[model samples]
Target chain A: MTVKAGLKNMVLKGVNLSIGYKLHGGKVLHLQKELNMELRAGELVCLVGPNGSGKSTLIRTLAGLQKPLSGSVILDGYDISAMKVPEKSQLLGIILTERNTVDNITVFEIVSMGRYNYTNWLGTIREQDRKKISKAIYLVGLHGFENRFFGSLSDGEKQRTFIAKTLASEASILLLDEPIAQLDIPNRVEIMTFLKKLTHISDYSVLVSTHELDIALKIADKIWLIIPGDKMLIGTPDEVIKSGYLDELFGNELISFK
Target chain B: MSKKYHTTLISLLIVAVICLFFLDIILGSVTIPMRHIINILFSRTDNKGWEYIIMQLRLPRALVALFAGAGLSVAGLMMQTLFRNPLAGPYVLGISSGAGLGVAIYTMLSGIIGTGAGFIISKLNYLGQVTSAIFGAVVILIIVISIVPKVKDSVSLLIVGIMFGSLATAVISVLQFFSTPQLVQKFALWTMGSLGDVNWDQHMILSIIVITGFAVAIFLIKPMNALLLGESNAVTTGIEIKKTRYLIIISSSLIAGGLTAFTGPVAFIGIAIPHIVRMLFNSSNHKITIPMSAICGAALLLICDIISQVPGRSIVLPINVLTALFGAPVVIWIIIGKKNLRTSF
Candidate 1:
């Protein structure tokens, strides 16, 4: 793992980033601040935190979907704020928590949206685009479900479809917001395992915010653990576990980690 | 829907539209013969009276019906897609109500200013009404659109829209109360929504606005498709949500406002035609639905216009009455019959 870390190149870096929302009257509701972090190539990093621990804010800030209250995020050595949406999308993909309620859209069409930046003004899918879409659907194990309505899918299938959509972009980095929050145990395990394999197969960096710490610990190369009102704890899963911060933050009299 | 099947369906719709167009022209008060109508359109006809009736009145009215139908339907589709609310339509959004209010205010102004200014106002009638209606629709749309981001959900936005419509109606009532009886009757007639009221000059303006609106909607095909996944997801896919929203609002207002200006708040067609197209096409891809909705809408309106004329009789019913009679039931059918709506919406 140390040797693998040595070979991995840094894909995303946050320098002195502050994550929060600004309320009215020029007041800033700070969540976390001055935290520097790095996501390396071919690494699946899990961001585990309690509810309202600013995990989503961090993910959104990192994805460039929301602005950082202070400091900056660098993607492939370029400032993310300076890049156009298309240019940023080419390098970074985001899977939001919002359920796609569009009932008439097919799985194929939903997956095809991943190629938005690559498609023409008419969004006409060429030969290359078709191959990418098919490959993405196949990657999610939804090969024959292309023409099926997205709303007809099981929760696991739907989440996999979203993952497929993110993959179809050919983005070097992915930021998923609570991807498996609504899934069953099997689905969660399946998604985490797939994400782990994906990082191993390709030099794609994944930063997924999830509450499923056990699955994340089993699959993630690095853990970004937010302990609330304190600096985030980042290290290998074993290292984080050994630090005793996990027990101090999450353990209780009735429920404690072994 | 497969590509081949879609092509077949589209061709059938085009044929239906053509048949309806001719039928609309032929079945007016006099019931002009189909061959004579065809010859009147393509070549000279010997009968001056028939030629004048077909050319001057029926032809223009049919043309108005065609454009108005297409415009209103496409506008409704845009609203439904943009808000992601199946119930959303131009009328529901208070766009037409705004137009009605504008015309009411104009009539009130004419009444207050008396006969000295009445002649000038009447002279400026269609142009004045069109400008005011467009202005009013745009204002209401802007208000509704600006509130979109602030609202928590589409249900709230829809409620806000309905409230705005009610507000406009209330204001129009006040104007009607103050206006002269003659002006009130004129505005009332306008409210019933007649396609035959528009002259060639007014039709030319309506056609220009509606076509421009359609052109804009076509340009929005890609962004709209991206938006089907909802705005946040659409943004991740590199769609500029603000710009797309503005374009959609502009295009919809142009079409809805222009149609209302000419036809006086023709209802049902705007809201119903999109669902019909969606059901017929079995797909929500904007490319297929947009053009298909336009064609289907045109055909529906022409049929409505024919029915409104009350064929073989001198009396003509209001266009709004027929559209509501047809459109409401179709919408109900879509809701109840297609249980897939829960999935699609």
Candidate 2:
């Protein structure tokens, strides 16, 4: 559990990781293998490859939602693979593809829940929590719509609600799986642009699993080009983009932004 | 104030509740006058028998209807929103069946165990029934929690809950098969679901529990709203979804389990009223929805209670039968409406 020297920069660590899950037929198939990756601070990292390349599995494993077959996901040098539920929540903020519906609640109150860790066991909101919610709304560019109904929101607006909620968590690091999966084209552009802004100014690292390679290329600070045949090529976006890794990785299956 | 709009609706519901209360007091198997009941309340001299009949029989029955309505309605609202499935309610989770199974056990065992001819004539027997119902509800809740770590979809989990419900019902039917004819009559009567069995003391206890259940549900609005999106989404917002889920199931059980214990399993309001509230309020805020559901539930149940009493001459119908009459169609509408709208929950 001790923090190592080079590991100080690591927000998340997956050492010798094997990520996969049981299918509907109840068979465990390996999506990837023996991978040790360090996700650093304040970097927007994208995972891109062909269909069913285990992009989501990797995010789920690192987010502590699933158990890895081999190796460990060490968050902030702490072995989070076996951490308690509440303890795990404090270190990570996650946005998955799941859609939510609790009827008749405002976007503000929903986003404010990101402060659950900051509140007491009784779970009442504090003034500081209010401040965080306002900040998150601002970050998501949802300033005037605080009182809007979540059920009434457009898909883009709802996505922003979830993002504001994630922001309210005060998490130093985020793991997003297909953040734009439910968004329209324009909203997709806005969320990615905002995510890019988050990396530079928010001092928070984000690891996103996405099929939108073109969007990721335009925004990501770094790219973790997951080509699925060998070691993951990790470097600056310019380096990864210029190397034609995205084209070779997709192999003309129509997943690339180009 | 939008707060004022909520308050206005509550006051309107209370007014409806009061009208229903006095209406129940006046119109009964023997029709009494509004003037006479008022005189009886302040009659100075102890009109003990008449007062006892009015206070004991009529008032408690009506209040029981009110609280029972609130409890089931709130639990349904919580469950429906949490699961994001329109069909999800306390009944879907097997909580109602769990409570019914408890009643079935007591009703059947008291026969084989043959405690007495008038076993239910005593208050202790009622207490036993309540405790057993709570025990059954707790057992189902535990099973629900164990499955939480396994399943991801709220709708699929609801399906699991309903499957457990069917299992509980199947077991109860077997108990009904073995129990004596009279005991079976008692069990069947419980299933018909009336508010009449609540005497003064039982009425107070049920009221306290229902009110407390509501308080706890409103208290968890932050996490409950967080929970709407999904478990992990809630957690990412610092909501411990596991604990929040536990809180919701337990609190929902406390309400649904308690009402089912005393009043039998009343249907419809739990399933229908939250939707009505959501529709009327036009917002997705629990701050509004919680209170809105409470009022909408109370008013709706008051109307149902009045309708149940409408046989008029002497006999009264069971409230549950009347509720199911209204409830089933609303559910059908929601199902059909869901078909048309491409939306979540």
Candidate 3:
């Protein structure tokens, strides 16, 4: 499946990206340097890495939450950092790892916030916005739970609510950080399957970071494997696994490919 | 709750506020009849004394109570949302102590200056006290705003605000200890929180300030709702976090500081009203919570003022005492009713 060069299907592109933090004393703490990547429309890309491998940092940089040490993340042919907050948000939706602490807010209210950029000054949800909000909630399989309190939801339900919120944002690209970290095995599989279905059914690109390598291997159209020392291995899961990078990355003792 | 239900609840609260306003006017130390009150309000009465009592005294007092209640509650709701803590209120951020310190300084200095009982001195005293209170509140507000950026979490910022309040209280106490007995008594009376202290002139100023604060809060409803999801999410949702925060701080300061300047920091209404409204509506959308809390706060404070008047007796209880006595029990009941206390936090 070769992508045509002149088409606008490339939803995200990273060129020579170096992601890390700059210290207070004018020192640069570079995590990963000189990285190039591209994600197309309708592709489910999984970013897998062990703990402290800068998976979150890379995602943050790509989502325009942090400035890369040296490169650019292009979303829809525009540099993400150069775009204004609302403009960037319109193109890319981000689901963070931290749990929201708001109480007494309903699931509908949380989902409706995804239409923040689209709503008027008063944030009045018009008919069109309502349709999108309900569609997003329905897609996340929370159709009848609109009025339920957000705080009363279980961990998996909360995760799904966040996903619905992102979906309601109507962004072409979705960047999620450890979305399934708190979910059980069934939930993890369900969410991954849902993401796969989303990519196939809709013109959306998903880049998810996870520690669940088994799920990533089974579901992801493309895998971004980041190891320690800023090493990045990107390919189809079978190619990466066949090349024995997966076994080497996690160690043969922890995981083996048949 | 459904949108229709929210609309109905808001309408009910507004109606309750109107009824409470009339009740506040009718039941005072003088115990004027409801019919007489209506007559005074609607038609010119032959009794100048009744007219003066209804128009000049009770009318202004009731209006002051209404505005102060709404202002303080709105301020509290904003602070609670800003800090993401249910207990956060107008006074929790040291604005009240700053106002107290201002009054303390004014009374003590006026005592030392030997301003004997005269018309000019009385006028100066009223103006000086309100001006000083607003100044002190703004100073503390600026300090808190500056420190907010440096603090890591809402809990730490809350602790810092508490410490600031205690520090201001200590300074006020020191001033009180050294002042004359008469001056100390005057300051003590001010600390008791009186809705009756506001004259028509002061009421006009307070109404303008409170209305402005509410307007600013209304403009911030969208950002405030975004903030409920937490700061990071709020930012990602295209809310200008710093701008929204600054607006909230300014509005909170204006509402709380202005009311405290005139009314001497009425207790419990700010902290209690928002929680009550949240529980009643079973929703946290700021669009619903802000207006409903304002109306509920006004009604509750009017009821408290009526209770303080002790209908049959001439001697009135301090407004603060009645509020704390009534509000604390409701809060306790709410806590006990909930299975998980984490929602309040």
Candidate 4:
């Protein structure tokens, strides 16, 4: 895809980016190199790749959790590396793959923590913050589970709670790592449908990483396929499928597209 | 729990603390009547004998138990939250053992150096023991803080802390092995722990240190709540994990070090009261737990002190022995009753 001229509404952009690690002996371990990407408002993009294909590394680099080996990730045209944590958190909400270990906290309390950046030193929830928390929980269909302990929730419910937490943050761009990895088929479909609905209802730009290729093909506006040899193919699902890159990316033995 | 329930629980705990305070002051071996106790507390009575017993003996002991109990419990709660471990406590990072080693060194060498060693043991008396214990605790704290930055995982740091504690205990045991019988007996008595040794001046200092530590702890409640989600989540929440960790370490050190320096490592209260509070409140919100744990801790220790005094009996049991006997059973019951032990607050 060509780089567009208007960049005002762009939530995220990566220019000449190489995402990977720097070794102790001063060696740079580059996973993927010379990447250019842009995520716009109200777009749901899916990032898919094989195992050990640096999908998590790319997400981490984009979320400003780690520094790029070269170039930069620009969020709202500001360099993500230059921004403070609170400033970055205000613009980007991240959902990690790790299961939350916090126990004995109610769902409402977990959702309210998304206001960490906006709240005062004591983290007192204002009336407006409560409204936002309730709305987020309602959006994820967890309105009645407010007082339930997070530890007692099912895996699907836990995933929804995390999404509610991210929604409560009110960040324009949401980055999720395997958001539906642990969900059943019904929950997976529901979550995908909800993500798709969120883009239409609100100006949220979501970039999600997942292995469910069929769901991504149906729901994502743009698909980011990490092909072998440190390259990425970015286009609409139809464009990529017609280009025959998905077949080349995953061999016939491992996967066959319907 | 609802706000109303929280308020009610806190109120009941406060009332219990008040009742336990009176029980601790009134029910000692001498059989001082409740009226005389009240009179001695309120009026400037000319009865010198009763005044001396109530004011000098019972008052300081009760105050010591209250402060030491509150301090140790707060320290334990902070440690458990900071490390995200169920077994973590005030002594997990070698603070108590460091204090024990300090007392052992003092008692063993005070005999060897004779009474003429003015700076070491001759002049300060109880003050000297407190100073040395604090010094030793601070030393171990510095070592732990220095190592914390190098270790990436909290579990690894917890293991290192346990190793440091074991090292301190081994050194103390060696000191005990070679010391004179009289010196060994004094150190053994200190190990058994006593709240009656503190005077009014020491009480003033202990209260000041404990209050400061608790203030720091209260200020850290928000960050600690964030930390319950684990370190990466906390970082994503815009909390500076390094700064919060250092504050927790310093606050815990202050409270545990002060209490151990004074009360000679009073056991069970530090490790048990937070669990009790969590169970009773049915939540792990640090804002609620921290203050409630302090009140419950004070009450629990006051009850234990009353039990140690044995009501009308002249023989006072060691505080450590009674704490373990009382506390271990409750902990076992909590473990048995909990259906999901892994998620225990």
Candidate 5:
């Protein structure tokens, strides 16, 4: 056999992927490129780095929101571009930074959006659809908010409501871009920990981008330190814990973890 | 209590309506009391013109206020929910302008339809006007659909709708420039908007159109709620967002289109009444919003129509002028409300 670092369920490959766009650097306009990335399922991979490190641009390419500058994104030995939107939606559940609200919409109604792939064009919810909605709401711990007006909820509650919406998506691979950016401190911890447990206990896997280095080291099964002064590396939180990654990440002079 | 609550609202509105309708008829430019007005409506009156004034003129005008207000406002409530924008109204879709152009085109051709007579309307030509209004509204609706983006965020879509309204206005103005004096006068009069023009037959047509259109709109309650959460979110939640948006625009346009086609461009109900319903119900749920706007819109229009008349003179204000009097203030009020202001997204 061979040595493989990630958990058993996930094995994804990126073949010579080069991604970037033109950015103006005063006198000159140039392109930024990250040549490669390989992700495995069952690992909490954190894409941590500095502001202009192309972390978001990299994530955007992986999520199929943008076309790659060059190279291929292959998932489970299948070309990503060939897959249908519905099929892609089923495989990857994404939590973007955008929040959704409706006047008379309940938490359950919003979460039920995850089941659209199963519903017909006529727009009616079936029995299994209801079950999925309930499961999603329960997963996000928003049980009683089923009938609340969407606009009345607080910001933190709104974020959790979106997570509940994501849960109903029934995806095996989760991609989150700063999911806790809109949350309170307690909610941030609660949501992050809950997501971590879900990835560890279930067959699902998550790739998240965040600035919370302390929390990332504490829970992540594997850390992806997008080093400032070097190439990207994948290892455990302990291995990358004392590296200069955090110091360069925040541009702090002392380089101490609070 | 919920049953009693709606009943109480219905009862109160009905009572207010009786007072408003009587005041609109008997108190206009004359001090006829309750008994004389009853005599004018039913009994053989000594006056030659009394029956004509009460039967043909006053009664039709009152019905106009009742239907025009409720029809446009109910349409507005549905649109605001459908598009998730408080500013969406019949005017936004260019329905009024489109239908007006259609009627003007019909009026120019009214002579050919055998109804073109000076101050003496023939039934055949009048029917042509009705047909033209519906056709115009439908055609403009199709054009607007082509230009509108089916994106999730309806906030920017509102701007697109406003742009469409301006475009339609420009086209109609060009149409007006080429028309004869008589036809131009007719179009101008129609645009000023009046509840004083339609007869009993026209009223029946508008009633049927509004009732059917609103019925279709009511069926869309669940889907509209789903859409407000976001299109992708709505789609995954078992709603076909594009199909739903199409259904809603068609129904709302039909109702508002039918009304404005027959009655010119009655304004206030389409823009202001939905916000009023939101404030009163303290909820934006369509179940409450739809029916509440129906009742409240009718009442508000009846009041505005009553106010349009001089309390004791022959002076009559155009319905459009009166709606603008109230609608403009509401536009400013909406701009000042912080809840509305917070939406930059």
Candidate 6:
């Protein structure tokens, strides 16, 4: 059982994956199939797609929140589907698109929730857990805002709080679904840049689905362009632009990337 | 909002609860002096009349107010959290309506079923009603529990609960239409809700159930806190969603069902007290809210009971009437005055 790890330090790998929903009468609605995706440690990847192109479905499938229609998701060396929830949680974290603003909960409390699996049955925050929670709040640039009510914070601050919660988990792989969807231009740019900085400084593998193609192209280490017909074009931003599929998907006349 | 402020507020609530507890016992149809009531409670009073008034009449009634208030409020908090709906209460899941239906069947159908059953039921009386109410509540709760696995989300389950409630109400309505006026009045009086009907034996059972419910709520604080982060986020935090949901549902049902069995589906307190406590503490931390809700709920119900007795007046209003009259305005006032009221859901 002495299998050597890969040279590139792949943190998350989706092997021959099929992503979709199981509808009424056990009818399988396949969105995409046989998609082999790789997210390496310290890499920032952006999954760009048209409105109905299954970006969220892919992220959910890879995160193991939803079962894959077929194939497997491997985390580090173990099979994701086979791993228990708490064990899988220690390795992966996700920030969903829903802005679930809990009323009356403070930023500190929300971030402390990331330590749920690590805490005792009573969810007591030990000194070490407290330090990690504080560090996470600081890392997300929300130091003084810790005691502020989550509902009172701005949308940007709220998103940062959620990110802080995810960061507190110390998961190596982070998946975000439309993290900056509702933000204004400035806040959007700030969140994207903050995520970019996170990937560079830490051994975290980040995958975010976004409609902000320009920012994604500018900062992403790799661009995964999903188009119609359940197909994905995976490569560096330069390779994606040079391939001319980006222009074709946007239709050369309406909106060209290059 | 500060820890110190919360401490001060909690202390204030405890003092209010104690004072109200005494006030509730002191201000019934026959107002008794504090000293006399104390002497009676401690068994040192020679005034048999005051002693009887305090011990037999007002004492059990006041205790009912306290236990029902606290238990129902905690149950309401759980339902609100589980459903993420501001209007959700202990009755939202149709547990109360099911209890009502159970009562409706017992009170109205017994005579029609024949004199043998009616004789037994008449002899059983209060015990029969409590048994029937519990049976009804447990039945609806079991049905709701069975549907939990089938539903995809909490919202769907909330709808299912509402549907079951409506179904129970419809059945009760048909029974009412066909029954005699006196029997219908008996059922109607039960619907008006009461804190005075529970005897000492029932009080012992209610106390045990409410105390156990509080203990279970304490154990659920962590998982409930995790749930404050929406369902998906909660799952990411390694919370067992199905297990947590089951614990919350069963515990809330036990408290709400037990209280309804004794108190005839006491209204408003269950749904309103949680909101008031949340608004007062300005914290959604279950650690703080659960205990605070208990105290505030107990205080509110005692106040309601005092008002219902009308001090020197012999006429007593229904408990539900006073609760809705007072509970509605207070919740409205808090929501209106406090613009920064956070949505605890």
Q: Pick the candidate with the highest DockQ.
A: 1
- Which ten-residue region of model 4 chain B has the weakest summed lDDT? B114-123
Please report how far candidate 5 places residue B196 from its true position, in Å: 4.1
Sort order, DockQ high to low: 1, 6, 4, 3, 2, 5
Mind giving the per-residue lDDT tens digits that candidate 6 earns over B1-345? Answer: 568998898899899999999889889787677788888898678898888788888989999999988999999999988887888999999988999899999988675764667677777877888999999999999999999999988889999999999999999999999999888998889888888887787788988987888888888999899888888888888887888888898889999999999888777888888888887777778988898888988999999999999999899999999999988998788778877544665
In candidate 6, residue A1 scores what lDDT? 18
Stretches of candidate 5 off by over 4 Å are A1-94, A100-154, A167-175, A183-186, A200-207, A222-258, B1-66, B82-84, B103-135, B149-157, B171-185, B199-212, B230-238, B307-316, B329-345
Ten-residue region with minimum lDDT total, candidate 1 chain A: A1-10
The candidate, 2 or 3, that scores higher on DockQ is: 3
Q: Give the lDDT of residue A200 in candidate 5.
A: 65
lDDT of 4 by residue, B86-133 (tens): 778988888778888887787777778854775756566577678888
DockQ, all models? 0.73, 0.41, 0.56, 0.62, 0.20, 0.63
Q: On a 0 to 1 TM-score scale, where does candidate 6 land against the true structure? A: 0.95
lDDT of 6 by residue, A1-258 (tens): 122233237589999988999999999988888899899977899999888889999998898888999999999888998888888887788998865558679999999988988998889999999999999999989999988988888899999999999889878789999999989999999999998888777767899999998999999999999866857889999999998887777655677777
Cα lDDT for residue A194, model 3? 91
Residue pairs with clashing backbones, model 6:
none
Complex DockQ, candidate 2 = 0.41
All candidates' TM-scores? Answer: 0.94, 0.84, 0.93, 0.94, 0.70, 0.95
Binned by DockQ into CAPRI classes (incorrect, acceptable, medium, high), candidate 3 is: medium
Instruction: Return whichever of 4 and 5 wins on lDDT.
Output: 4
Interface RMSD of each: 1.4, 3.7, 1.9, 1.5, 5.2, 1.6
The docking category that best describes candidate 1 is medium
Winner by TM-score between candidate 5 and candidate 3? 3
Tens digits of lDDT, candidate 1, A56-112: 999999989889999999988899988888888877889889985587889999999
Which stretches of model 6 miss by more than 4 angstroms? A1-10, B44-49, B113-119, B340-344
Of the candidates numbered 2 and 5, which has the greater DockQ value?
A: 2
Model 6 scores what on Cα lDDT? 0.87
A40-90 in candidate 4: lDDT tens per residue?
A: 888899999888788889999999998999999999989999998888887
